[model samples]
Target: MILPKNNYLKARNFILTNARMIERRLFEFHFENGTSEGVFHAVYAYRNSDGGFGHGMEPDTASPESQPLFGIMALETLDEVGYLTKEIILKDFMPYFKSITTEKGGIPWMFRPKSEYPCEEHFKTVKEWAAISTTAPLLGILEKYEIDIPWMKKAEQFVWSEFERIKEKHVFCYLCVSRWLTFLEHTKSQDKAKKTINNLKNWISNNGIICEDKTDEGWGLYGKPHGLNYAPSTKSILFSLFSKMTMESDIKELISRQKDDGRWDTWYGISEGTKLEWAGIQTLWVLKVLNNYGRIQY
Candidate 1:
């Protein structure tokens, strides 16, 4: 595949710079500006504070602590930093994985205790969302550690079962499909992964451009349906890149959308009436995908 040349070198340099920033933060653990403690600290704080992870808010940001679903993003950031390790993976991170799952094998979007007020909306009984979102990261972490979590295996089974349940209706969001594909990739289930990608591609092709919402069809933010679409975080871009589903025309269009500064605004999540910044991390992520696919050029 021929890679686009525009800002390739600049993007690479930018990623290197950010990687250094991450390194410094990890070492210092108290960077004055920007997110503190790198991925390790973020994961530790998020799990301890919120009981689950999402995008919005930092672990150490403020009071009434909530877990940012972006914990998965943090892990992705750690992977970019080359800081992902078995010890850190198992000890500090995996515990959060356990909390998100219920006895019936359901995983919620957020996982604070029942006593938490507004935070309660974060809960969900949907096995599909739980397995796709939670288990994907769990699987990714396990693959990183080369150690298996039995619960994760059950989670995978649960996800596949739920996926089969919904495959006919095609009710899943593209983001869910993308994450499911990611989990399948980690588990080395190429056939199942490819099937999911084909289904997503079919949906996107027939449904017009995937925008943040059903209203705008042009490159939906993150996945389909409007409310969930957050343009700034590069969730859509990363998902496309990782799934290897981008058509040449689509990729060129995405390239055209790149800001002059070589960054894109992507949303992680919202917390305490605030959105988290994840562009730098997202940029590095996309660049890594392009590099691996031999799609990066100077």
Candidate 2:
């Protein structure tokens, strides 16, 4: 079954009314024959002078200064619109990433915001350690584009070493593990990446990370990840990891969870504006995934 045309129109109206400019452009680009250049212009407005992104690029913080988390979000935005180019990666993203990278050659989960703007409490808890959560997905995106930079080499080494260290312990957060899955899917180190994926597949299945059942109403919300969280597209490497039944059930749940206003609810955020912003982002994400899975009628 596919999402009805009326439902898609409702979502379009909701986004035009309530979403941020970035998300609105993304929605149009993906579904309404919007140009890549249009989306690129919207994304470029968030870039700081230091070549990083901030000023609420992520909607999680109002900080104007550059942050690692926002950098990743920027990359994701460009990737989604197919505007992630080598020029941008090297001249813009790489320099910023190098500036903020930890001594271990990986980006930290976040840094304390210098601005007085409101942000989530977790953003205040500074961790003085390199995080594979951020680094792995960055590497994965680089790998997907076949962009081989010297800095990326070091970051890849850091990611591989971290995987070796964490192999013994099957414990991992869904967010971090999700990034690792992306890395494994794209990294040239096929032998090692495959071995790690085999080892972690069961852990991903058994861990409280994925919402495997369709009847679980609270699956995607409240910071919980679901099947689409891990495998947003049929082409994702994580796609083959799940059974057909499991994937279908989660897709059904996703389709059924749209609110009356034609948006999905976001569970984590500080201000009401942040909540609405994330709702717009989440609604676009859901529609994109549904489209990729052939569940949306054009």
Candidate with top lDDT is: 2
lDDT by residue (155-232, candidate 2, tens digit) is: 888998998887635333555666677788889989998888887776667766565554655677544667677678
Candidate 1 regions exceeding 4 Å error are 1-68, 111-131, 168-174, 188-220, 224-246, 260-262, 266-298
Q: What is residue 22's positional error in candidate 1, in angstroms?
A: 5.6
The C-alpha local distance difference test score for the whole of candidate 2 amounts to: 0.80
Local lDDT at 128 for model 1: 31
Listed per candidate, the RMSD to the true structure in angstroms reads 7.6, 2.3
lDDT by residue for model 1 over 87-205, one digit each (tens)? Answer: 76676566765765666464644444333333323342312335456556557557656777676667667777766766634323644554554565566666886786566555554
* TM-score against truth, every candidate: 0.58, 0.91
Q: Each candidate's lDDT (Cα)?
A: 0.49, 0.80
